[model samples]
Target chain A: MWSWVAHRVTGMLIFVFLFAHVLDTALVRVSPEAYNTVISSYKNPIVGLGEAGLVAAVIFHAFNGVRVMLVDFWSQGPRYQRQMLWVVVGLWVVLFVPFLVRHLMHVFA
Target chain B: MSTIEAPRTQFRRSRATRSNYELWSWVFMRGSGLLLIALVFGHLLVNLVLGEGIKQVDFAFVAGKWASPFWQTWDLMMLWLAEIHGANGVRTIINDYAEKDRTRFALKTLLLASAGLILVLGTLVIFTFDPCPTGAATADVPSFCQTR
Candidate 1:
């Protein structure tokens, strides 16, 4: 149940990001000046935070995806689901630190 | 000869059935995963690194990039790969966790609807996007729009 909820939520997040990305990129067709303005908005600290959120979403979706695959298909994976969940948590923490740091520097510095 | 003839044994049942859908799905997951890594990383590197980096991205920048067929194709590939990959992954989860047939059907119905909607909307936005709006106030238009 938790997994289903998470999958749905992450799917939604990715979908939203995809739409935003297309819009943002589409702005270029409007004119270089408008494109620059939109791009500049992306550099704002708030948008930086949004980028971090996007990263977190992708990581969660990807790692949890692997876990789902294992439980569904692999013969021995169900027995280790709990262990895999922990690993997913650990991996997220590890990956998120660098991501946070990089984005912070990009935003603040 | 009589003793040998009496030793015939019964055949055991097979544990698993063959499925082309399952095989294709498995292949797709791995193949799309590999492609996604490249598409995703390239997307990141370009947006976050190349040229003036993230700060340099703007309306004109985007227009310039999309004017080239390369970026268009790249974005298209990423869109299709990620959507299909993520949707397939969700489908697998639905099959595994939903115990009731009705529940499964409902969830899958929603999933398909959402995926279809997103794919259609996304593709439309990509191909039909107009950077320049005609008859807009000059101030509202980008500088380049004025020149054109």
Candidate 2:
């Protein structure tokens, strides 16, 4: 139940970001100066933290989505749903920790 | 317990009345989810985790990437897939939450309109993009433009 909720929440958040991201990328077409001016804000510390959180949301959503697919398709999936959730968490930690470490360094640097 | 049907019962569903739109959407969600994992992870790794990370992202950086047909196709594919996937996800959410018929209809219409606009706009931007436009300060454009 919690997993489902998290999936929905994260999915919504990511979608929102995706919308804004497209707009930001579109700035490149306007002019190089316009694009660079906007993208520079992304390098600041606060937005950097937000970027970390955005990545966290994306990683969780991606891993949990695979779990949801497994539950629907795999024969033993339902039986191991709980265990699979744990696996999702484990994988998320594995991927996210490195991203956080690397990204924070760049952000703070 | 079997119950007899009333004379006016509409018991049979017409063979052609069923639509597989929802089923296809379900399949698409899973299939696209898998593809998005690869596309998005690569996007993040290249744009945010590599060399200067986000700091390296600027007009020149973008110009350099899109200058290659490979990254342009990669980003174009990513743009289309991610937008459609996101629009569908949000449509599901709107259906889940907006209980009233009018509210649901209004919200969905708005959602589709915006998503469609974004898709069209983003596509145009990608294909029509120029690394350097005449009359812009040379400093703002990619270095390659100087050779022209």
Candidate 3:
């Protein structure tokens, strides 16, 4: 159940990011100056936080993806699925902490 | 005395069918995942933390960065890795859960469609990005575009 939910959620998150990215890039067609204005808005501290959220989502999706792959292809994976899930959580914390710290410093300092 | 015979089911098990596609997919997931960690973080760091941070990001900003082969390659790698990784992951899910053959087929069809669409669109955007437009109001264009 968790796997199904995670799959759907991650898919949606990735799709959302892709949509935003495409739209942002399309701005270049409007005018470089206009594109610059939109890109500049990304500089905001709030937007920085939002980007961090995006990073987190991507990490989760990727890690959980690996987990799903293991279960699908390996005979032993189901035995360790729960353990692997925890490891993914651990890995996420390890990766995210430094990223968050650096982002905060850049935003506030 | 009576002799009894068992009937074979419709789904016959093939003993000799072998394909390395799954193995390659597995390897790709791990390899691309490791690369994604670095590429994604570096992307964030450069776009959001380096120099004047996100404020410096502009049309000219992208044009300047993409002007160099390094950034273009970086972006191209990221796009390919993430798209392939995510698509393969979804494929695994569809195989695992979608028991009905038609359902699995439909789901995978959709996944492939979306992935292919995104990949082509993204690649086009990255490679064909026009830093300068031929005709535009000067004030509405970046200074760099004017010079080109």
Provide TM-scores for the models. 0.62, 0.93, 0.70
Query: What are the interface RMSDs of all the models?
Result: 4.8, 1.0, 3.6
Query: Which one wins by lDDT: 1 or 2?
Result: 2
Ranking by DockQ: 2, 3, 1
Of the two candidates 2 and 3, the one with more favorable lDDT, higher being better, is: 2
Order of the predicted models by TM-score, top scorer first: 2, 3, 1
Off by over 4 Å in 1: A1-16, A19-47, A56-99, B1-19, B51-55, B136-148
Regions of model 2 farther than 4 Å from truth: B1-8, B11-16
Docking class of 2: high
Between prediction 1 and prediction 3, which has the larger lDDT? 3
Question: Against the true two-chain complex, what DockQ does each candidate achieve?
Answer: 0.21, 0.81, 0.34
lDDT of 2 at A85: 99
lDDT of 2 by residue, A1-109 (tens): 9999999999999888988998999998887888888888777899999999999999999999999999999999999999999999999999999999999899888
- TM-score of candidate 3 relative to the true fold: 0.70
Best by lDDT: 2
Pitting candidate 1 against candidate 3, the one with the higher TM-score is 3
- The 0-to-1 C-alpha lDDT of every candidate, in the order given, reads 0.72, 0.90, 0.77
Clashing pairs in 2: none
Compute the lDDT of residue B134 as modeled in candidate 1: 61
Give the share of true interchain contacts found in each model.
0.25, 0.86, 0.38
